[model samples]
Target: MCTTADESGMTTLPEISLAKLTADETRGEERQRLETACQEYGFFCLVEHSIPKKQIGQAIEASRQFFALPQSIKERYSHAAQNVYPAVARGYGPLHGEILHPEAHTDPKELFGLGIENEGDRRPFAGATRFPDEASAPGFARSLLALQATVLNKVVPQLGTALADMIGMEQGWFQRHFSPPTLMQRVIRYPARGGKCGKHTDGGFFTLVLQEELPTRSLQVWFRGRWMPVPSLPDSLVVNLGDMFQALSDERFKSTPHQVAHSGLSDRISLPFFIYPDIYTRLTSRQGRHSFGVAEMMLRNMESVAAGNGAGRAREL
Candidate 1:
């Protein structure tokens, strides 16, 4: 802990093998590595997670084409028209629409987001899933849907079970709460004007991200009072713990602050899957001193967050 970090910052974040983490013979050692990663840094790269790399690329491309559409066509699907839950989470958030930083400023980016779809309940967080029509961008909706289906089937359950075990919870705990889970997926595109997105902790339990194929050290995390760069690798995705998990685990895990600090070069694209407990799920800290519902925390955050004018996601609760 005393050594000064060199230029190759955060180069040693453990890359866990998901296959081994699930196998009976190797689960023990691999679980320890995962536990440490969550508790110490709250972020790491996930490999052998069974997600299709090619599909992720296609989704990114689809997002690129979608964003590249004429401004008029893009605005046609704005969150305002859809009447998003907080008035700015789903459908479309144009450039500089979100405020992820506490200082109340807009991010230099544009995004399209969708929440849980097809559940029996069509409530905001539970079921109100929406996507652009096929006419918006050819195969855009299908590509993202296919990608989400893969993550939901492959990574979410496995990772959730691993975390439940790490915190000493009984079997099926995650499954119980995550039955028809509350999820939000986003495709964001930032232009060549290099700048930093707001620094804030995620509001969900965790996130799985597929970064652009090229090695752009844009994603950074705050650790030990310094920002360290997350390495980008081929055929693997990035994972980070989030606020709900931190509270649910009684802080055994951390919800570290992170940001997208990109250098103006080429357009940057990212696919992030935000996982949460059922919106109605209430969580209590490990020691039982803190308690709150997932919806409550989210609404609290939305009250003063970033829709350009600062009131939807500017800061975390």
Candidate 2:
């Protein structure tokens, strides 16, 4: 679906306007286009989604301010320090904290992760996220939570419904699976002179990325045994299917391999929402008996990575 090229000879990701797709007049055609993009490329750029640009800018600024805090203050919320029930994976991870690609090297990026905040939930990767003191980062938590709500309540559900439609399932079929889903928001900062965040596929169902504008293109996808740059586009979000989606779809869709090739010229910031189905919902493939819940698989993979076993290499997640 992404066949167009820009003046710089870089292939542009196929774009889908959410505004047009949501309208009654163009829903069907746009749905078909979305299906094609998923089956062919596993990635696409989303535009005109109705999310306010000003809010996104504010969220970015908040993230920058939080990351700019003193290392000791940030470490107070680190995953190693927080001891909440069910042990949710929400907190800051210093640069080279976890080895994403143990064979090559650890990732040269700092991460701040937060999940849907449910104080009463006792499920793994669920419940309240540790945030900085209000005095230190005023309104930071509120802004991020608002953005998370928008993505989970609006953007993700719309895409899930479309995907169900594409597979000839009833409308809301996939949406049902995501009831009380495990949605995680991650803010990554790759500093200048940092090494690449080595090639790996995401471990969730899908990921929606808001990449900050940078002087040089850094995101690249492996296609046809070679890596190709994914050009940055203003006022757009990049969406890509993950290994779970590919597995559940019986590989009808791809979980493309991608990586960040940090230019080492300027810092880069990216906000990604990793959406997953409910922790108890099972994933099954018509091709075999490979059925498992989203949270189960994700936790297994994360633990594997934390143990230095390199989970992404096992199943490309």
Candidate 3:
């Protein structure tokens, strides 16, 4: 039995593992915390989440190794050409000047990217991954790839189901539309500067961030009209839904807006895995629960967002 506040500002997340409940009895109770927190805070820390601490460390180490490479070496895989997978995935993207937050003063940061879908001649959305030669990161690539495979195959599906249930949809409602899909990862290295990441909301369903390490300045989430600091949990990862989740859940879930401030002391490193639905599939509510087709509704929403210039570039590999 946990209690939370509403939009009037008096809410708290239930001290419970909302993800572990499988019975209707517990689900009824869990819904109170989820609905209230989502409506009011738009973000909640997930404790007891099973993401491995060791894997997180490996991912961080891998990012460090890659970013530490000379600019020329890192640029070998840049996102220059388009294959179903490009050899240089945007090739070690630029400083955080234009992209991360388009119209804001962002401290320069370097980023590496990869998309699960449309990579080389492999299967389209099938389990195909293209990493730089192991020689690039030596002993690091295998561990990092293992972690990625685990996260994409195991954690993401569970998170999606939890999200579906949290927003009043039947469990597994979203899992079907996301296979062989476009899952992207961005490994960001935040340099020490007083500048901050501009304000923005994620463009898709949910983002799971494993903070490999953080500078003194932590990432913050915008909830209920205020920026609240989210300090890293010892062994926990951060999870947040995005605009697409908000849309598909019919406003039942809040796709919280968030940003990171520039750190002046130590450099920051964060690995964000962006999980999205297949481009061709639609995301609809449960049968007998909603009126519109999920995909059509989402497409309509996308059109509106694009018309208003709200949608950012699609995360295609």
Candidate models: Cα lDDT each: 0.78, 0.77, 0.60
Clash count of each predicted structure: 6, 0, 20
Identify the leading candidate in terms of TM-score. 2
> Taking the tens digit of each residue's C-alpha lDDT, what string does model 1 give over 1-317?
11123365424666888898999999999999898888778888889998887898889999999999998988888887664465566788888777777573778888988866665554555545456678769889889989989999988999888987787667888999887678888888877757457788887888898988655678887877777876567877888887788777887777888888888488889889989888888877668856998788777766657433232222442
lDDT of 2 by residue, 206-274 (tens): 889988866566787766566777766778888988878777777778788788877747778888898
lDDT of 1 at 153: 90
Scored by lDDT, model 3 comes in at: 0.60
Quote the lDDT for 76 in model 3.
63
How would you encode candidate 3's per-residue C-alpha lDDT over 199-229 as one tens digit per residue?
A: 6677678888777445253676765566666
Once fitted onto the true fold, the runs of candidate 1 whose alpha carbons sit more than 4 angstroms away are: 1-10, 128-130, 306-317
> If the candidates were sorted by their lDDT against the true structure, best first, what order would they fall in?
1, 2, 3
- Window of ten residues with lowest summed lDDT in model 1: 308-317
Where does candidate 1 clash, by residue pair? 99-306, 305-312, 305-313, 305-314, 306-313, 306-314
Clashes of 3: 20
